[model samples]
Structures are given as structure tokens and as C-alpha cells.
Target chain A: MATLDIKVLGPGCRNCVTLDKATRAAVAELGLDASIEKVEDYAQIASYNIMSTPGLVIDGTVVSSGRVPSPSEIKDLLLAAQA
Target chain B: MSLVDTLPSSKGKLALVGAGALALWGLAYWVNEWLWDWVMYGVLKLDSANRVVETVHFFVYDFLKIMLLLAGIIFVITFLRSYMSVERTRALLGGKRSGVGNVLAAGLGVITPFCSCSAVPAFIGFVAAGVPVGVTMSFLIASPLVNEIAIGLLLTLFGWQITLLYVVSGLAIAIVAGWVIGKFKPERWVEKFVFETKLHGEAIDPSRGLTIKQRVGIASGEVSTIIRKTWPYLVVGIGLGAIIHGWVPESFFTSVAGKDNLFAVPLVVLLGVPLYSNAAGILPLVESLYGAGLPIGTLLAFMMSVVALSLPELILLKRVLKPQLLGIFVGVTATGIILVGYLFNAIIP
Candidate 1:
């Protein structure tokens, strides 16, 4: 399996931090080959067309925006992406 | 981790539980005053007229009331708001000119799901997508200014007439302020990078394909998160309100910021501009101050300024707006709020 590229987009708000942690935990829990990156630049975040902070993007597709999904939900999203 | 997350996954059972909880909440709200009265005056034998006892009673009653109001309203608003997003709002406002656009933008701003933390990016996205600066300004102003929390509290505390007046005046401020800023030719004032930056991907609409259960889950999560985050401010605000209710003499506010002071509204707006706080923290204080003989207009202006024009939000906007544009943004919005204050003061009396 190829390594999946996941990006958490926010300017380091509390929700963003929680999302980052949840994503990492989910990745580890599922034993998936993934690299998570934090996108903090406003221009780049806007380029993704998400007007809300704490957006979750997997493989360049926005999966969640504006709110933090739970760790289990993140795992579900990750699994959906793999399939 | 929300309590909703631990519940059964069957949609029908979840809906049943939700309805049950809501019914219980209604019962609790209906009985809150009497219950507090019983505990304070009936059971404890405390004198109702005593200042200490009155203050404590006000605190207990208000704390529960505001909590219930926050939980119920936020859940409903969040659930409904799942149907709207900033991306869709921008699409609605795109390619529109200033005048009618400003009106629509202000209206949309009130309904759009936006956070101050994302203001910079949203601003960039709107402008880059051909939404005029003034229209975008109206959206930004109305987003925080005319929110559900303020509406819920104002209606609960000040009655429907005052609440309607507040909502109307808030919309007026946004519309007129954006129109005035548009006349100034604001494009030159924005940072050049905001124009130069090219959007790369298709805008994703988050509201699409959401299940009812998912929306409910989102609402419950929002209720818990916002309450947990703001409880400290709410407690402090209500505590201060309790003190002012029972202890502060009416003469103190009458002399300080009462109707007789011509500069009261502007001064309060100025003071509020620098101080950052949400409506939850400020409205309880506003209630206490209103009780202490302060005029409603000045208090409303103060609340509007604090929530709409904050230091942190300005700093964030500075990334996309030149200092000149930021100055006009603050100036125009502040002037509108001050005018509304004076207007309300004169008419309300």
C-alpha cells in the first residue's frame, strides 16, 4: 500500500490541535502507512476552498471542515479512504 | 467525547431519547424559578428581601436559566446550520455589486456557519471569488454581531420587542457600514497578495450528503464544546450580575453612564472596541447594568462593539487587509454602532 498523505488545515486553533492528535492516534490505531501534515498558511487553506478552520484533507480531498470529528470518526474516514 | 456518542446508534431510538430530553428540559425551565424560590425562601427560611439572600437567589436562578438557554438554542442552531456553510454563502454572494449585495451579504452572514478564527481565509476566498469587499465586510460584521446567542439571551432577558429592535438595528449597522465602506473604494486598501493568490481546487460543500443523525451528533458536540469553553466566562458574568442586582446602588450607574451623559455611547463603544469577549460574557453584565439605570442603547452598542470589532479578529484580518482598510473597517463599524446606540436611547425613552 502507498503511503497516504493527510493534511490538517488550521492556524493552530484548539480544534485544529485536537484534530491533529486524533488523526495521529487513528493512524497509529489502524497501523496505516500515512504521513500527516499541518497546513497553517491562510492562502493555502483557502486554496482548498474551505472557509472554516480545522479542515481535514486526505489525499487532497476535503473530508471534514469547520468541526473536529472524533477519533473513531477519523478512523472511519481513514478506512473509507483506503477502500 | 460527547454523551451523544455513547448512545445507541439506532436513529429512531436516538430521536426518542432526544425528544425525551427536550421534554425534561422544558419541565425544568418551567419550574426553575419556583424551585429556586423554594430552596432559598421556603426551605432555608431566608428573607426574600435580604440583599445577600436575593443575590444568591438571582445567581442560582440565572445560572440554570442561562445554561438551559445556551444548551437548547445552540443545539438547534447548530443542527440547522449544518445546512449552510461559508463556501455556499460565498457562492451566493459572488458576482454581485455593492448595494443589493451588501443587504444579501448581511442577511447571509447571520445564517452562515463561520468562526472568527477562519475570518482571514474566508475574506480572501470571498474577495478572490469576485465578492466585493463591502459585501464581504457586511457578512463579516453580521456574522458575529447578529448571532443566535445574543438573540436567545436578549429575548429571554429583555422581551421580544427589545430583541426585535436589536436584530433590526444590528442588520442595519451591517448594511449601512458595508455600503459606506464600499463608497471609499476599498479594493486599493486590501493586501495585494489577497488578489494575487490563485485558488487551486474546487470548493467543497460540507453540508452535502449529511445524515440526520450526523447533524444531531454535530449539534450535541457543539453544545457541549461551547458550554465547556465558555462556562468560566458565564459564571463570572452572572456572578457580577448577581452582585450588581442586589448590592450596587442605582445612583452609581446613573452618575457614570446614564442617559444624561452625551458621550456615554461613544465612550462605551471605544472601551468595548479594545476589550474582547463573546455575547455570553457581556450580556449578563449588560442585564445588571440595565438594572442599575444605564440606558439600553449604550449597553447594546457596547455589546456590539466588543463582539464585532475585537483586537484578535483585527489582528487576523491584518494579514489580508492593509492598515488603512483595517482602520476604515473599525471606524465605519464603530460609527454605525454608536449611531444605533444614540438612536435607541432617544427612541426607547
Candidate 2:
């Protein structure tokens, strides 16, 4: 089983909520053993160099930002990452 | 007497209102110039730089002129409301299907200067009007980048090179960025409201002729509405422009933004995203950046961001789009802006 560390980063805004929901759904569908983390600290978020929030991080890499990824696209990437 | 009430008919009142507003503005300009000059030397410790100051001074003063021009434009739009129908839009931009032709149509998008952020209303209207996704995207991107005021100012200050670079890339980004948005037609990410406009009115029917009286009546109403809509924006916008014009220093801008700093270009793009500004307001800043030593790519990136990602326009767009699509637009625009900034410097002189 592949394990993934996913992060939904924002200031607890509405977009962050959507991204968190989307991330959970992606994680469950892919059947990957992943723990999702939400980073809301402004300083920490700024350190990531993302001016806008609701960014997605997979395995410490910011994969998608400024928008949430579609479930299918996320699942596909998860499948590939496991393989 | 109250300004609106004093005028006889609403339309006649508007003309009188226009005259009153201009009179107020002329007085304000004189006071502003005198106070600003004093502050420049006394508090700010800045003085006329061997006459470079005058040109630089024009940078800010010009925004005031633009505000006045906008007022005139509003008065015209008041009358134009009757004549400037979507049917007219179809007449002008319709019938041409060529890529180059489509681009030219898209270029005209900048002339409209609509809000840059994702809005349900414009997105709805464009889609409902059956404008292609790419074409709509081009207009969306370019609408904020180049406008008459911005272009005229660029031409006056920077000469042909800066102006040409601005126009070509502004059009190119509109086309390419639009195509990219089209490619990732993640329909699901678009909020429910955004799709509503697309649900109906997919085609434009033939235009009907208007009677002379109907035309005149509509024109008068349009002038009032458009003027009212555009005036608040102009006053607040020029107020900010005057500040940017007077305050931001050349040495500081050049030191940070200059050509040697490779990262400066993307830095500008990043900086521009949050601010609520238009091409007319931002052009002066961009010109100063170049004067200060900013790389062309960086300046262009900043310009696109200022035009495309301003907060007020973004708020307007959010009414139509879900937060996800909004984020995508901002993200995509940032990336596209940076890419084009580099492209322009490479292709042009």
C-alpha cells in the first residue's frame, strides 16, 4: 500500500473547505493510505510562496493551486503515484 | 439647488451635471498640483529631476485627464445605449471565422475594459451570446490589458516599441490563455451560476431597425446610466493613480525591478494579482518600472496581472463562478502572464 501525505492549505476560507472535501474524496477513491493536513497559518502559507490560498500539496510538493482538481484527475494521479 | 434636481429633464440635467462635474474637477486639479509640488520638495525631498520630473509628473496628471475623458465617454454611452446593442456587436465582430480575424475581434475586447475577475454576468452573457470559449477568453484577458487610455499613454511615454510589445502580447495572451482555459474545460469546477447564462440564448437573431425617436430616447437613458456607473470608478481610480504617480520613486522602482533581476518579472506578476486597478491606472506604474530598470518581461507580467486579476473585478466574477474556477483563472492567468512576459522580450526589440 502506498502512503501519501496531502495538505489543503488556506486561511479557512470557503475555497479551503471545497478543497478539503475534494481531497478527502480523492483520497478515498484512490484507496491510498493518506493522511490529510490543513495548513492555515498565514506565515506558513506565505512561506510556501503561494500568495493565494486553497492550494493542494501532495508529498510536500504543491501540486495544484488557485483551484481544486477534479476527482477523476486526482484519482488518476493517485493511481499513478501508487504504481 | 441639488445637482440632479436643478436640471429640467433627466437628459438635460445630465448635460448640466456634466458641466458642473468638469468645473469641480478643474478646481481640484489646480489645488492638487500646487500642494503636490510643495510636498515633493518639502516633505518627500524629491525635486524636478532635470525636467524628467515634468514627464514623470505627467504620468500622474494624465490619470486625471483620463477620468475626465471617461466622464465624456459615460455621456456618450448614455446616448449609445440605444444604438450599442449586442446585435451591433454581432454586426462588428460576427461573420468572420478566420483565426486572425477572431484575434482581431478579441483585440477589440480590450477597448471595453470590463472587470478582469471571473464574473457570472459577463461569462453568462458571452456564452449566452454564443461567443466561442476561446474568443470569450481572449476578450476576457485582453479586455483588461489594453484600452484606449492605456494605449494612448504608452504611446506618448514609451514610444512604438513598448506600445507594440504591449498590443501584440496583450492579444496573444488573450488568444493562447483563452485556448488553454478552453482545453481544460473542467465543466464541473464551474459553479452552477456560471452555467446558467450558457443554458439559453445561444444564437443572435437578425437585427431590427430602430425609429429615430426610440434611438434618441434610449441614447439619453444610456448616457445617464453609463455615466453613473463609470463615474464612481473614474474618481476612485484616478484618485489612486494620482497617488501612484506622485509617490512611487524612480530609484526605488529601478533598484528592485530593473532588468538584471531575472526574478523581477514574475515578481511583478505576483504583485499585481491582489490590487484592484485598471490598464489606465497601471500603465503609469509600468512605464515608471521600465524607467527604473525593470526588465520588459517583468513589466508585462505586472501589467497583465494588474489588468486581469484586480480584486474588485475578481469579486465581480465570483458572483458567476464557483471558488474553484476562480482560483483556476487566477492561477492560470499568473502562469500565462509570466510566460508571455518572457515571450515578448524574446521576440521583440
Candidate 3:
């Protein structure tokens, strides 16, 4: 299995932290080989063209911006990407 | 590195922080009163008859006082903001019924500390977390209108009585307006993308397990950012207020918008809808109007409309909401504000 690349983008606000946790849980539950990186710089976050924070990026594609998805929902997203 | 490594170990350093805050408070008071007196009356030698001079004095004094207040309030609130994250709020409101959710969301809105412009992210987060749209609306409406910064400024300028009344009524409006919207079942009005977008990643709560040093650093950054963004509006609002204070005849406003005028409440609300201003930017104008003998009801209505029914916020909401839902949102909020205005006027006057 190929390792997955995941990025959580925000200024370290509470919602962003929740997104980070949920993502970690989803990855672990699926036993996926993935590396999670957090990007907090405003310029870097803006480069993604996301006006809202707590954004998520997987495999170079923007999947979500401005909301925290639950672990189960995140699991479906990871499975789809794996396929 | 361990978090404890960053902790301040010296008692002297802690005492220095306390002393610094006291010094700043004294300086702020001096700037608010003595500086205005020295510059406007002692140096300028301008009498009340000189409308231009008086207006200039009003502008300078209010500008300084409000800026000082903004810095202090924003710093403290931003520090508190680090404690209350959007995800935390989502967890609180998620999976609740509309009635309970609306109340809880509105209450949380007062403490969460996001401005109207930044509310979208939280709104989206709430929606994705399965929070009802109506509950989310309550949070959005209450966040901007009932924030502590605005309330602190209001208390400084208008006294605690008026401030408390504003807070109670504002929250009531947010709660009722949101509850009514929830009943409308406007879920279809949300953009398809809001529901469809899925994020995949390891979510870490950035505010979790932070040291005091880190929290303070974050708060100071917030103070600078908020002040930079809001200063221009504050200047413009105070400038307009000075003009009104110095030039406009008391009789003029009283005749038009006084308590006797039944149409004043709705009329002011209509006038306020098109203008975009935050509470800090608008309260100075409200003070000048009150000074000019504008009825309390009309002034309150105008302030609410300016903060709560701002056109810029409406345009921002348009991104996520269809026109129909947006229309309902505006209609319901405006009506609630107008009623509050009338009710206050009847009771007080």
C-alpha cells in the first residue's frame, strides 16, 4: 500500500484542532499508511485558495475547506482516495 | 521541547506584567480626558460656537478613547478565544434539537468571539458536523451583534444599563430569528457544495495542550490583526459622529426621529440596512444621535440594523445560501429588530 499525504490547514484555532484529531483517528482506524502535516502560516493557507480555515488536502487535491468532518465520514474519504 | 520550559519562572517577571497593565490603564485614562481637554480647549481656544472646532475635538477624543478600549478588549477577548474553538462549539451544538440548539448557539455566540466576516468558517463547520441550519444561523447572528468587545465599548460609552438592555434584546432577537428560520426548513437552500465536500486528514486541535506563553503570543497577534482591519471604520464612524454633534441642530433630529414619530423605528431600520458598520464603528454615531435628541428607540433600532442587518454580511451569506433563504433570514431579523425598537420606546418613553 502507498503512503497517503494529508495536510490540515488553519491558524491552530479550536475547530482546526478538532479536524486534526478526527483525521488522525480516521487514518489509524483504517490502518492506512499516511503522514499528516499541519500548515498554519496564513500565506500558505491562502495559497490553497481557501478563504475558510480548518481546510484539508489529500494527495495534492483540495477535498474540504471550512468544516470539521467526523471520523466515519473521513474514513469514507480515505477509502475513496485509496481506490 | 517540553512545554514547561517556556513557563516564566521568575516572580519578578510576573509582577512586571501586572505593573505594566496598571501603567497602560493610567495612560489610557489620561489620553481619554486630559489630552482632549488640553488640545481642544486650552490650546485651540475654540468656543462652542465654533462648530468646526467642536466637531474636531469630538473626533479626536472619541478616536483615542475607542482605540485604547479596542486594544485592551480585543487582547483579552482573543486570549479567551484561544480557549473556545470552533470545533468545541460544534461539539456543543451538534446533534441537538432546534429549540435547545438555537438557545445554546446564541449563548455561545456571545463568547466565541468571531467577527461577522469570519463567521463563515464556523458556520460551515457546524453544518458539516450535522448542526441544524437554524442553530447555525443563531450563532452567526449572535456572534457579530452580541460580542464582548462591542458590549465593553457600549458600556464604556453608554453606561451599564443601556449595555445590559442591548445585550439581552440582541440575544433574544438572534434566538427567535434563528428559531423561526429553523421552522422554515430551508435546508435545500444551502449550496450543494457545502454538504458534498469531504475532507480527509489527521485532525489535531491546535488549541489543545498549549502553554500560557503560546496562548499570549496568539492573543497579541489577534489584537494587532483585529485593530488593523477595524481602525479605518472606527475613524470614519467617529468622523461622521463629530459632524453630527457639532453641526446638526438638536431640533432637526428630534423633529424627525423622536418618540412622537411612529414611523421612526422602521425608517431608521431601513436606513441602517444599506450601511455597513460594526458595533464599534456605529456606537459613536449612535451617541451623537442620542445627544441630538433622537429618540432612544430609533437610535437602538438603527444600531441593531447596522450591526445585525449589514449588507456586506448579506453578500457574504449569499455564497452559501440561496436567495430565498437569505431573504427569509433578512426579513425575520429586521422584523425582530424593529419590534425591539418599538417595545423599548413604548416602555422607556
User: Which candidate has the top score in TM-score?
Assistant: 1
**How well is each residue in B233-346 modelled by candidate 3, as lDDT tens digits?**
888778877888878888888787788899889989999989877776777778777877877777888888988888877876787789999999999999989998998888
lDDT of 2 by residue, B1-349 (tens): 0122233455565557657866886777566666656666667777676345654465456555555544444444433443333324434554444355347556656554232322333455454445554455566666666555566666766788878877777777676666666566645555554344322222221123444333334334334434444455555544544454556676676677565567876877878878656565555556544655556677777777877777877775565456766776677777878888877666655
Query: What TM-score number comes out for model 3?
Result: 0.77
- The digit string of per-residue lDDT tens for model 3 on A1-83 reads 88899999876766688779889988998999999999875445545545457778888776765545545557877888888
In candidate 3, position B5 carries an lDDT of: 35
Isolated chain A: TM-score per model? 0.98, 0.86, 0.95
- After superposition on all CA atoms, what RMSD does each candidate show versus the true structure? 1.5, 17.3, 8.5
lDDT of 1 by residue, B73-116 (tens): 88989999999999899889978899999999999998987889
- What is residue B131's positional error in candidate 3, in angstroms? 1.0
Question: Which one wins by TM-score: 1 or 2?
Answer: 1
- lDDT score of model 1? 0.89
For each candidate, what is chain B's TM-score?
Answer: 0.95, 0.62, 0.89
Answer with 1 or 3, whichever has the higher lDDT: 1
Question: Which lDDT values do the candidates have, in the order given?
Answer: 0.89, 0.57, 0.76
- Name the best candidate (by DockQ): 1
